[model samples]
Target chain A: MGIKRDISHTVWSVRGNAVMDVVTRSLEPLIAALRAAGYTVVGPTVKDRAIRLTEISSAAELPDGTGDVQEPGNYRLTERDDGMVFGYAASPDSAKRFTQPPRQTLIRSRGQVIEEVEPEAPRIALLGLRACDLAAIAVQDRVFLGGRHPDPAYRRRREALFLIAVNCAVPGGTCFCVSMGTGPKATAGFDLALTELAAPHRFLIETGSERGARIVAAIPHQAATGDDVAAADEVSRTAAGRMGRTVDTEGVQEWLPAAHDHPRWDDVASRCLACTNCTMACPTCFCSTVEDVTDLSGDVAERSERWDSCFTLDFSEVGGSPVRGSQRGRYRQWLTHKFATWYDQFGTSGCVGCGRCITWCPTGIDVTEELSAIRYGTEGPSCIR
Target chain B: MDARQTGRRPRLAVWKFASCDGCQLTLLDCEDELLSIAAEMEIAYFLEASSAPGPGPYDLSLVEGSITTPEDAERIRHVRRVSRRLVTIGACATAGGIQALRDFADVREFTSVVYARPEYIATLERSTPISANVPVDFELRGCPIDKRQLLEVITAFLADRRPVVPGHSVCVECKARGNVCVLVAHGTPCLGPVTQAGCGALCPAYNRGCYGCFGPAETTNSGALNAKLRALGMSDPDLVRVYRTFNATEEPFRRASEEAEGDA
Candidate 1:
């Protein structure tokens, strides 16, 4: 949708939100402003032939004409004729990498002297978080911050974040944010949000927080008319219709717990490599295990926490042997936990429906297909629940 | 712990059997930490480093290479008797190495083809891991073995604790390091799904599929991975060949390769 209506009435207020518009070329100034605001600006960039989140100093680094073709167990960077800045659906790794790092040192010891390492949280402005990513971050916040003893490192990183979200104009082949009610549009959990319109090559910006308002006031922008907002709405509306995959989340949060013996577990277990790809790629999978490492000399030692997956045999280790020893048990644990038990633990489903697990799986095992296999006796041809 | 607290360093001995001495060189490659490791333990009998031989009854023995000869088969039992704790290093010692390919074929046929005098050569029909001949405390899984993991195993044994070697797949390390899935993204037939994490997901980081140098992970569905590999244009022969590499004799790899060969 293009801004086709009359724009002589410069600022037609839409639902009491101060909306503005800026051409694509002005994103450089926004990047400069974020850098000037004492935040390390991280965004999606073309790295290692994929859309990877990395530190960027200029808006020129954004994947301008590059989009990604993502399918189950496959991802490829492609050239888009539309030249959309945020054309890609999701990155390989999400903002979770920035907030909850893969590994963190908890304590250090030399002989009898012990030292607890303080968490370091540098201010970061994440520039291109999608709606599903924001949902994933919210899920993580509940896990790491809403608990009795909040994770200090995760809390510090959470507080230090300045999120800039973007509405998805195009959905990838494995995306199911529409089914999860988490995407196609940025609803909340962002300082600022943008809907990139292609024809005129401009951004329809919506302020979500006071910090966003402050940044908007600092940057040069024109008032967005009702037509511009409608076009932006249309972009998300079209995206909502074009989801490549969908999970039947109807009673999944309740049903999956009982689906423990649903024969689908064995079917999936047969295909599941137990390689921990799904858990690792999942944005909201917050399980971790601590390891104590010592140097060649017996004097120095350190305890560090690294991301662990239920797919690992040691993850469920209790006494001498693993509780979930079989791939069948591990697979069941991971799927059931993500879809069902996560609500019991955190009052929210762990999956945000970004489909990273599907795209990153080496065997192209689609979660939607597995769920459908459980719900219906077959991988559904037309199931969108 | 007793060795250090009692004012005496534990004796560390390095032994070789049938294959290349690359695993031993990994110890010397630790130029920065070699001196520090030497300080912690007495380098009692490392033939590669020092010609000066120390007597048996060592505290820890780092054994490399596979048991391929009659003498090697007998020597391992003696080594096991002498050493308090025996740790096998590299694929050769832990899984019979590349030489274990002979386990699938006739060793006499190989000997007759290679050796000028086949009668003079005394060999075992199957090149097997040290564990097949004698007990092993820990087995460090890698082609040549990672030096850091080697050190960890050494120190952990000395300090009376379990080593921190994980049984998880290489995908864990690959994801932790933020390396994109080469198998998924590029349709490469990777053994990373079955291979254990040790080399820090080195192959995938460089945009290449893992050849399973560290052997099959604790949990692996190689049948499923082989199915995917087949979908990615890998032939049955290709599957057979890929699984028969560094960790060829690992049970899962051996079985999968045999299955692929059957299919071929």
Candidate 2:
């Protein structure tokens, strides 16, 4: 017996020589197939001077040979010699935007006629999703769908989606998914995981779901060999090794609460703009509040929920008094919750270590640096294994 | 006036001014207390809570943020009209917030540094507290007001009584918590002596000096703190930065900061 079959799906790998041709050739066919199946094909494309997820009809629309340089409040485009279409790291916009839009209408009412609006189920095939984003989706699933009060709208949108995950070959300046134990390779929660090996123009496809297996079987592909598996493993390792940042999460939950009053918060808060760009770019930040508006005529009324951040002074308002009255307190609350309290609440770190917050912030406030300050300030016993 | 016998719950309204919508979020953080509060009070105008906002002659109004623009100034007055007992929450509403850093410098310089088109920005030269513009019934201090205190205030309002909020210094809380004083022990420049009590003296417990997010305590001796800060080798600029925190505009702190900078 060579290898036991795990399921109905076949594990296939393409020769390095045939990788690019297979990818280019399959791109249009996959889009056409998805479109014909009444699904919108959404993938990475150059938009607003950066590679962002957009609707794609063909491979020509893909962000070919473009990589993104991300820093706090600064992002620029860089060209790559390799014609890899999905060569870049994650963009400022996460898949959460599509799943949980910035503002969503909850209910509408007009006099006695109160109508509850259910969001229309949109069938979307997300192409070239990075591993960090996949983990972010999992974090969101825990927040919106797995919570005690499941959001009916988010559940509907999530149920009607197909995920195509891509193994990141080049990590961005801000990426630290390896430290978060969430990325560099697509391990699960995907319909299909594609590793692009362009020499022979083929994508090494691994099916994660039943639907993915069906899609793989429909496509023209070859069975995996020992050499192909080794190459795939090597590429994943390289991607993991490329991460520029690492967060020491060892006993962070236990340490942060103990070091709550550390002077480090004062140092960090002084520089923080508190503009809330970090929370906006953060994929796991689920804090939101509802807003109601009546038309000028007062006949038609609508309620909408929009994203809110803890950094804002009004976020903690109560009978004419704010609890966290200083930028220091607010900044401390956000960081501690993400690194420490989140583990107490969710059994995991709130941050996925995407580094988007670090890069997109106007002031370049790094969470890792702040955490380091706490680690050094205290005299507690070390927990790093 | 039994609430149930009256057949009309006290109307509650939430208002926002010129700040990020963070302090308002603290109310929503009271997830367990919220539904119960809703059961007791009729939420008339919480834009962040419900879409159907009833016209307000609210018994209680929770106001957040500061007056930073001309529009905010007018809007706050309108809020005061609708609210019978208007309470200003957070540092911004009470002490002009971190945005009040604009008060120390030329607004044009700050705007040029932050925005590409400074002309497009419609901001007052200085951020001012809601009390400066309207008759505030109460002022709650904090960068983000504590959720528990918020609940207490709401419960007190429902009962037609004054809210139980401590006005002592952070030093009192630090002593109550039995934490070693970071300032005395480590020679750290702590503001716990002059800052308002709240946050349960969190910074001192973490082995850091308090940065005075809760603003001024009643009869705060900032002059004494400034002398101590100078003794601890802090520069005049550093002292200015310290006084100009969450409640920099408050009288004692403002006067002390001016004296420290030799402007008095």
Clashes of each: 2, 47
Considering the two chains of model 2, state its CAPRI-style docking category.
incorrect
Candidates in order, interface RMSD in Å: 1.0, 17.7
Clashing pairs in 1: A247-A385, A248-A385
**Candidate 1: lDDT of B202?**
91
Candidate 2 A-chain TM?
A: 0.89
Return the top candidate by DockQ: 1
Candidate 1 has an lDDT of 0.86
Please identify model 1 stretches exceeding 4 Å from their true place: A1-15, A18-24, A379-381
Predicted structure with the largest lDDT when compared to the true one: 1
- On residues A1-385, what C-alpha lDDT tens digit does candidate 2 reach at each position? 0122322122233234332212323566667766776779898887646676778898789888998776433456789888877788877667777677766788899876889988866888899888888888887877776647877788778767778888888887777888899989887777778887766655677776556556665666667666666676788899898886777888888899888789888877666645455777788887776656553233566777766567655567788777887878888999999889987777778888788788755446777767876887545432111
TM-score of chain A of each: 0.93, 0.89
lDDT of 1 by residue, B4-104 (tens): 77888999999999879999999999998899888889999999999998997899999999999888888999999999899999999999999999988
Question: Candidate 2's residue-wise lDDT over B130-237, tens digit each?
Answer: 999999988888878888678767766665556657565665456435344455334577887677776888887887888888888753546545655676778888
* lDDT of the candidates, in the order given: 0.86, 0.74
